[model samples]
Target: MERDLSCSWRARREAGGHAKGGKVTSSDVIMVPQIIPTDSVSVGRAATLALRCTMCHGARGMSEAYTPNLAGQNAEVVYKQLRDLQLGHRKSAIMGLHARNLSDQDMRGLAAYYSYLLRETPPSSLLGQRKAPRIIQVGSPMFNIAPCASCHGGSARKTASSTLEGEPENYIRAQLSAFKDGTRHNDINGQMRSVARQMTPEKVETLAKYYSQR
Candidate 1:
């Protein structure tokens, strides 16, 4: 059955002018039919991926601590990260092995699946009442280290490139720490590293708490 399916796909490709060894033209790049199998095996694999992912990422991708909340993350970003883990660009003992077993289709499906999850909003009071040490205030005056909203706020804010409305605070802090310690120095633009280095331990905790509350 699999061989038959492969032959059929090949035939369709040839019909669309995609010859095995011939020079390809722009018109030959027609859309191929999506061939995801709706069998028990596929469903089981997807279910397993969801279950395994939930253990660390959270039931619906809303983690309580350090683990990144994958709910509502950009699908492309998630997909690329999975690919990076598989390629060794991203280092994770567990994630690298897990990503290795996943096909491109599986990665895309997982990305799409997690991206659709609804993000949980944190309490406003928690964000409003969080206090920080006085030194952070004087040290990082440029970015407003205490109040997370200072840099992560309105359209005109310093880091207004992306919205931090529903992201996981644990993930945010992890990235910041990674930047500071140089464990995750893959950021070519250097914006994240710069921000992370400027933040003290107190400031990281303060912002993490404040963002999590929001």
Candidate 2:
């Protein structure tokens, strides 16, 4: 699996012409062509043409390790993140480059494409409780941390915030860490940063596991 993943990324890099051995300049960024018109209902097709997104994010939008799964996410959340990447409200070496050439309409089209996909696996409790995760039930009032469910809806729905029930563990952990360290500040009014700053590593791990298991 590791080798296959490496090969997949390598192929994508080579396809982007980044394999040329030289300092990466601003002009080296790859720009995929938009195929479908924005007014059409073929936004998914357009996104596939503009960005072979499935090369990194799975075909069905299930993601591996550091990539957050986009399946069943709110279109608004996905579009906002892409916009943030493009506008520098969020920072990512790869995503920023990919987003730099995208227009607002393109971002929305791509978001719509991913948001409608289904997850590889439905989330379930590791202990078979079929109930909310423990962290969702209890929050540390001492740190002014509200229950996650308070912000993220309890059901399988997405809001301005992401739908976290089935996100990748490492992705969630990394984002939490970013928020804690002040590197990811896209959350409105620093809400995530505030919560993450008050959370310990252990708490972050627990939350990641709990949510990933759903």
Best by lDDT: 2
Q: What is the C-alpha lDDT of each candidate?
A: 0.57, 0.67
| TM-scores vs. true structure, each candidate | 0.60, 0.74
Please report how far candidate 2 places residue 152 from its true position, in Å.
1.2
Model 1 ranges with Cα > 4 A deviation: 1-48, 123-171
Residue-wise lDDT of candidate 1 within 1-214, one digit each (tens)? 1111111111112225443566432223322223433345653566568788887888887766667777765454466567657755457899888899998778766765666678777566755575543432343566533333444455434411233555567777887888787676434344556778878777777666555665
> Candidate 2 clash total?
0
Best by TM-score: 2
Report residue 137 deviation for candidate 2 (angstroms): 2.0
lDDT (tens digit, per residue) of candidate 2 on 1-214: 0011010000112234442466432224322222213344656465564447777787778878889888777666777678668856678999899899987667767766666667665533453665664556767888888778777865633246688877889999999999989777667656788899998888899889867765
Clashes of each: 0, 0
